[model samples]
Target: MSSSCPTNPSSSTTRPHTYNRKQKSLGLLCTKLGVERRRIYDIVNVLESIGVLARKAKNQYTWKGYAAIPGALHELKEEALREKLEGSQGVNAKVWDDEDDDETLSNSGSQNDKSIPNSDAPKSHKNDNRREKSLALLTQNFVKLFICSNMELISLDDAAKLLLGDAHSSSIMRTKVRRLYDIANVLSSMNLIEKTHTADTRKPAFRWLGLNENQSSNVINSRKRAFGTDISNIDFKRNKVGVFVNGEFSQKPMKQKELEHVSGLGQVDKSNLKHCTKQSSRSYQFGPFAPASVHKVGPSENNSVKQVHDWDSLATVHRPHYQNEALKELFSHYMEAWKSWYSEVAEKKPLHIL
Candidate 1:
């Protein structure tokens, strides 16, 4: 006898709803489920997309309950079918037009030239609109995988492979997963899907709350309870160790008295220190640990004596010596001879050469 059970049993069957009607945070859910913050976001997006959870604010969500799921599924199915029909028609028309254009271009050279400019013009315009792959479009496609597939959940690795092809290197797949993480975060904020371990292998996977009946239990009944705590009011900086006091953690600003106490503990007497008169000397101080002086100087008295002696020797050497009248007349005659030679050469040169 052969068993008629589904190949992949619903994990949600074993995992019962533990959350109540109270508004819960994605962080709290992550902690409770022992899952990463990023995984929690993926789960939340799938849940929110199906009306299982409603977003109230940033990082906050309100339980909308599972009662709305049937209606949500019906709407999704209708939309999906409509899109499928429109896509098929659009694809067929596009193919026909492309084939007709190809035939016309191949048959007539003149028509090809005219069509070339028009085709090239659209391509240029398309190039202008081309942009880097958008995270939003990636997210929509990611969610569509769940919406279109029969699988209730999908692993990030599998999703990455599906979105980015198996031919991509490990680095490329890692990059795609990172981008998916960001998209998952936005979807989580919207409360569509949720992260959970698979039933068979206990590996992480994102369960689609929009379509699966077992996943419907993940939704909590809405209760008119007090408003959820404002996360902005929570002081994360106050407790580095994350110690909770009473019900919440708080960080109070330093009081004036505390500031005064701290300031007084390290107080010093500024007046007791000697003020530096020179800017260059300010960087160093005349202290016990001061380095030995590198410069050597002679005694002032010795310096003065050496200076006097040097000056006297220079004066003696430079003193004027009396010359005989005949020697002076010989020097003057040689100087006149040089001046006459220089004037002759200068005057004989051409005006252009000069």
Candidate 2:
């Protein structure tokens, strides 16, 4: 028997349900499972990919229940088979060579692809750069690995090797692993699969939750809890009728005076009222409709409107007395000398160099 196989199948089957659907911290899971944090992460990633776990927040996951696994696996299998058929039929005629895959992987991950629009053109070119590197697309491929393969529990190293092939460099493999880690974290949060140790070697692996025998029962109970009696007693109603005049769809209009009155009432006065009020009194300041005299600034006080100062005039104003007379004279003499030298250079004929 392979070391990856679970020694105790019963314990493995019941382990996921023990956590329930509550949000659990990664540390808590690690402590409970008696596994290393890194190993727990490996397990969480693969489980999350299949929709059994969902991430609530940082280092926290909500179990979505294992009942969703069967349906998800079925859908994934169908998709895989469909893709395989399409490939055989030459539907995807573009042969993805090693160079192309490397280039696509390199360009697609890590950052947002934004294109600057040409102002001269009426329509801007659509950015096709994002489609190749989309997280959603990466997630789909990651899930496809489980659906297409016969292996029940796959290690991250094995998965990376299989997906990228042996031709890819170590750095590329590392990049692929990092992307897989992200995908796995998201999938674990969804509760599709869960981390587990293999039976023989104690190697950390992801066990698919869909294969559980108790899934149907759990799903039925969950549905019952969610819907209660509401689903069985649904009441359907007819469409509401609108007022129609003659052949045209029209309703009675309000009088102009009435409309104006309503509009006036609807308009809220946003301007703040200024008034001297005692702090102790509750009714010291009047509301928005306060008298004009209460809002007026006092005659002795400066006007609220700002006075614009002439900064440019101040900047241009010369203060010759503030400068050193000797330095100023020397600068002026140098400026005259440079001006004369430049003028003489401009007057001279162009000299040809051999």
Candidate 3:
């Protein structure tokens, strides 16, 4: 006996519509169902798979009986339901419930059959798929959290504990770890998250460098390919009085006087930061390249020409004030870049699992 029952459309012609039918748009469907728009679309796809509703030329789904067309399970609803009893009595309500489903199936055959896919599958399979999708969402949220926090170096254990709901549940913890690694691998492959050894013995670490830098050294350090290294070992040496010029500043060198004016470096170290030297009165001489450029002129003119040191090539001025300026600039760049990098990363889809 088929589980489908035909709706007698002609007989119901005079009957008034019963259920409150409110037209629902896609956005409203998502909100009401508590599912993402994409998930709603997927559900629609699955419904189409079983043929519960017909899709019109405009690609919209109409209610099951709107077309009055018989589908695969049309005869199921007409099947007679049987009463069955077990040990304690002549008839059991529980047992009747099971038989009633069969009765319903037979009576509303096509409609029930079309809707059957949602209930016919094993519970475990459904749960497994649901958990998988949930894990993906968790990972995405974690990544977003990390970026928003602007944390440069973060541990996997911390990330896992923060994301996995039951901190004590080993199974949940393990699942989160696996998902994190999966996401990490995907980001690494895309060159978004760089994986490198931070230390000689420790495991590799991931770095987010989608940010700008100040002394340029900050940017270089951010790009440091070696991960898991001791933060103490990276020789963060400053060769000169680093300037934290704005990104809009020209790349060209500033004269000694100009450097003092902009950097507010006192006259004591001004000579060391010269941009160029004057030879005799007409030509400019650049030192650091003194020996090479001095050869381009006669002995007299070469001797007369003075080195005009530029800001870039200024002699090492590790004055406490300048060092402080450089450090402040470096720190600012680090924080800004980190925040920007993290935000950009979080906005993307989770890499680890689909």
Better of 1 and 2 by lDDT: 1
Candidate 2: 10-residue stretch with minimal lDDT: 273-282
lDDT winner between candidates 2 and 3:
2
User: Candidate 1 residues 1-354, lDDT tens each?
Assistant: 012222222232222333211113333333433334553444444444443343334433333323333333333343434444444343221211111222111111112111222453445433222211334234544664565545556667666665543255788778778777665533432234555546555556665543222333321222211011111123222111111111122232311122222111221111111110000000011111100110101111121111111111111111112122211122122212222222222321111100
Maximum-TM-score candidate: 2
lDDT of 3 by residue, 1-354 (tens): 111223222232222432111112334433433334453333332222212223332323332210111111111111111111111132221111111222111111123222233453456344333422343333333343233333443445545554332223676567666656655533332223344433332433454422122222122123222111111111213432222121111121211223211222111111211111000000111221112122211121221112111212222222223222332222222222222222222312111100
- Whichever of 2 and 3 has more TM-score, that candidate is 2
After superposition, the stretches of candidate 3 with alpha carbons farther than 4 Å from their true spots are 1-135, 197-201, 211-354
lDDT (tens digit, per residue) of candidate 2 on 1-354: 112222222232223433221213334433433334554444443443333333334433333223233333444444445545434343222222134432122212112111122331333112222322334344545555554544556556545555544355788678767766655543432333344545544455554332322333222112211110011111111111111111111111211122222111111111110000000000111111111111221120211110011111112112222122212222222212222222222211110000
Indicate which candidate wins on lDDT: 1
Q: What lDDT score goes with residue 106 in model 1?
A: 19
Report the candidate with higher lDDT, 1 versus 3: 1
Q: Which residue ranges in model 2 land beyond 4 Å of their true spot? A: 1-75, 88-130, 211-354
Name the lDDT value of residue 195 in candidate 2: 44
The TM-score, computed over Cα atoms with residue i paired to residue i, of candidate 3 is 0.25
